[model samples]
Target: MNLDPPISSSEVTLERLDPLSAAAARPVTTGAALLALVLPPLTLLSRGHEVTQPLWLIVSYAALGGAAWLLLDRSRSTRPVWTAPSAQVFQVLLMVMLVTAAAATAGANDLVRDDWAPLVVGVLLVASTPYRPAREILFWTIVHTLLCAALGVIQAPSAITDVPALTLAVTGSFSIAVMGFAAAAYARSLTSSTQLWHDRAWQSAAAAALEHRSGVARSVQQRRVSLLNREVVPYLQRVVNADGIGDDDREEARRLARSIRTLLVSDVEKTWAQLMLDDLVGRHPRLNITAVADDPDDLGRRAVLERRTLLRALAAISVERLSATGLALRLSTPEGRLAVRWEVATPRPLPDAHRELRSMLELIRGLTLRSSVHELPGRLVIEFEYGY
Candidate 1:
């Protein structure tokens, strides 16, 4: 019999978490929320005599970018304020950065210059939408950088920039710098997202592999049991019949054949039991071996009884290769005058019994588990007197 492992509970839980779902559900961080506290005032600073120089404007925008980055990085931490209210505030601050950056680039210095506000607001709106926000962020970042490009294109159709007061070289250099920052941020987001997907994929693949191995193990056990029942026992029965016997010895020969069949069944059962134990341990390599109970009875009343019923019933059912699920067993302990009921839960609910033959067969199987299958809200429940 082949022995493998089962999937771990942690693996199952991780599959349920669904990284794509989390990423989709997560909120987007906007430029407005993060830069609101810093950039609006910077606009005022730019309006007054203090911030007229293009170099100073560049430095101001760079500082705003740095501050937004800091807030975003800090938000990633497992802090309480990273949840909602704080997140909203941070988004607003980022929006301010977007507005200020756009105005600074457009060379519109009015204190309440609403002309470029639409462009700034548009960038923020795109940045704040969830589901592939990285892509959206990248798009807006490039759009802003392209605005700088368009400005340069307008100036330098003949050369580079027409602003003789400022070097075209300087404009070109800053434009490159803006585009570089956008590219870098987009690359970072893509890298982070790819790594996240890889991690989840690896985990899911490992879980699927474990499940496959478990199936293989169960299949091997079933096949081994089948060989003993269908081939080995029948072959021995034939052998016993072939041994020529007088009429007086015929009964003895039949009894001896039955004994051999019993021995074969015992051997198969032992092999199956070993395979199950091996899988239980193999699947959970880290499970404390010393703590695991060998006897099914030691697993507690519910577990032990269920395990016993499952093993015996499975062994019997395997001979027939039954496809049934949701089996219920009702046990009657006549000596104690106690009745118990139980049913099996399966992924797919079994059909209702219509024929007497089918019902009798099901009843016989339930007698093995001391339980029976209830059709609706399908379950197998075993009910019995506690003392029994």
Candidate 2:
């Protein structure tokens, strides 16, 4: 899958959750499909308590569930497969199911009334399927709290048992209030999870961006290396040949060519150094060499110098195409006073086939740690006091 920004608020919908939405959506549809089973029994039990009472009610439940399932099922196959907006709708439906069940239970003269069957089925649906349908699990969670609020309001008249004004609302209002609190807690959890996902997505995007830049930089450096190797060096050799004719002159020309070659090497090294520094600055803009060191301690200065040298070396080695995924370099002070450190990244969960790579990184880390430096995939650090 191609990395994109993240799921924003606008894209939070059932339509977004398409395919797996059906996994959850199926229950709702099935509930509606099976509503036919519920209505007949409820109608018989109600025994004519108004003409279309249980008939319309059961049909409505089935129809609502079925319609929602069908619409949601058709929209399956979107990237996320579940959106925040779709979750809200699912949460609302669950609350309705719960409240309707409670109401039917409360109104029933007999505890085992046949009408209670549908409510039982409804509770099973609520408990088993989801509080929220798809990725909108959290969004639905928020809506569940809203439903609880509504339920509490509906049950308000039952608050005072002895008061004629408050009959059906007493116990249920308190129950709904408690359910609301639970829903609120759940909503908070969902919020945290969603935020975490977005954070990860952004982090991945940043890594991808850096990787792209690294690839481009590596390509440019390789081209420069090729030009130096194939063209510049040969041109310098020709210059040496033209000047050198007699034996004495030939010796002088060879010496001059050698000096020119050394100069060329130094120039190429400096160019590579600049490229590495540029890449480092791009990756971590906050690294302030000035603020970090005012009066220069030997150890601090050496560490900075070693890092700079390693970065340059890595840039130079990146002239090889396939070997440029990432790099690590071990460095210690010239006096050997400080611990050694290295930076590295590879196909994490390092493959068994790459025993050499595994050995190299492990050896580097172990040796560095022996001197009190720690290095890992994302960061590296070294401390001078090794014994502690």
Candidate 3:
């Protein structure tokens, strides 16, 4: 439950906690994107006569198209979690389209009450709530809201209006403020719900572990059996089914036996992370997995269980994916921060492997303090630094 790099006043990502909410938002996002594509241009067509500068309107709709494309693009579809960089980009693009749309009639007309910019921005923000933290959404909302008012003021100089510029500004930004606040509130609600669910789940698990220790032991044994079934049992069954043992069978048998040996024998002093890597080494013994631990515990402050989930993901991509390659894992505690350094030697790196690696890491980037990926000659290096 003690996750590092926590979201604003929340346990972690809304996407991680309430994936159903995140998945549900996508259809709404697509709808909003289509609105962006359809609504503004139609509004411009009706009010096209009052335009002082036609070029600005053209630029505005072009930016609108960009924002729509940003939403529709499936480049990041493979990633399991929401990514901040892309979401922030979408916000920026949206603002650009809105501001330019405002600029089309900057000094000649009253700010259009039916401005699609602010409305679409708000709707999109709501759609993004499940993917982004409330604090981040609110920050961008406030900034854009101010810009909305500023647009009103800029247009008020020559445009005939019954109300004061301040009133106009406030009135102009009313929809944005309302919708932005709504999105932020929804985001907070999602975070709270996800946190409560996690706390309850963890408490139930703890109570069960304490009250029924034997059940927990049996569950662990079942998992161990499942692990053997994936590799060892398959090779054994193949040997029994085949006419005789070939060189390939013998090599596979040796590998599976090494995995069993590695699982059965464990150093009491080693951390769970170390044991995990040992298991990986057993599975892929051809990879000369050299591991060195500076301090016994990976994170001296957090519980071993707290760090396992993230580290397991780290190990999967960094160590488990490669085969017959020399890998080195270095775990050190520098300045009370957990720093993990891993390098897997792949003599011939696959095409676009770096992109695939980066996309994979994006799923866990929210959990770690910082991460860096370097594709060196004959090796792929990844480093993760965790905070308390």
Candidate 4:
């Protein structure tokens, strides 16, 4: 019989959260895309300038809109391939091309003209902040800087001569790229820190549980040793000294043997629920316990483990608050659903008891498919339905 507790669902969720995956990255990607989509139209509108080729402006808007949709749609899927570096690179290149085409159609000589094309490109680059790694972000940032510089020089060859305007365009684009990279790095760091704290908490809990179980085992072993010394040891010593067994000695030996047998069989093949009830009865003789269950031997390993964990938690709560006069536990498989119902009545209200045993209750709920807790006057009832 395994006495170790099963891993709770909360632990599994925490474990999954620790690893950086597509699901974790989706929110940032989606947010960045939405921001980029909104900024371009707002930038174009704020500038209030007519383009030389209205068709090119329309095409650019359509391209940006399509890119945003692609990103938002892909983020909804959990597949890693959709968020791969290659996919991100392709999206970035598409954005750059569409922005450049728009700029070219606006007339390169009028690049320094009151147009938000450069700013739109900058925003597009920033949109990659959450999805790409630092090295990749750096590479793209440099790429955008060069693209902006080239566009400024092409729009006005004389702007190259006018270093101020040229410098402004290049520096502005570079700054936006750097800011995006910084934001992405900060976000990654925050996620890592959160996962680290979760892992530490789980480790601390596991260590505490281990120490508790070890202490319980040690205490039980000490009691067993004391029992043997008081009964079996003395009986054996007398038989050894006398060299022959008399009627009193025989009776004493038989009694000692029965005691040893009872001790050995105490918990050998009992279910966890049965063992818990026995312990509860021993501790609180006045408390009445009625239990009904399917044969534990018929249950699968996982079902048994889950049942044990649930019963152990319930037993602990009941034993600590001996206000209950009656405790009833029922376990059955009705219509192929494994169900458990526990009812307890106490002299006073246990309104705060659920809060005190919140963790245990959470573990029980996590193990089962569905469960409910009801507080009625002096009685608390909990029901759980689960599967193997």
Best by lDDT: 3
Clashing pairs in 3: none
Model 2 misplacement above 4 A: 1-52, 67-167, 170-181, 193-216, 239-388
Model 4 worst lDDT run, 10 consecutive residues: 10-19
What do the candidate models score in CA lDDT, each in turn?
0.40, 0.39, 0.66, 0.55
Better of 3 and 4 by lDDT: 3
Candidate 2 lDDT, 92-183, residue by residue in tens: 55555545543543332122223332333333233322223323333444444444445444534533223332323332333333434443
Off by over 4 Å in 4: 1-32, 46-50, 77-82, 86-132, 158-165, 168-172, 188-192, 195-199, 202-388
> Which parts of model 1 are misplaced by more than 4 Å?
1-32, 36-38, 45-140, 149-388
Model 3 has an lDDT value of 0.66
Residues 23-119 of candidate 1: C-alpha lDDT, one tens digit per residue: 2322445444454335445555544442335554565455455545544443221111122344344445444544444435444322222222233
TM-score of each: 0.29, 0.35, 0.59, 0.42
Clashing pairs in 4: 108-155
Stretches off by above 4 angstroms in model 3 are 1-13, 71-76, 80-88, 108-111, 160-163, 208-388
* Candidate 2 residue 207 C-alpha distance from true site, Å: 7.1
TM-score of 4: 0.42
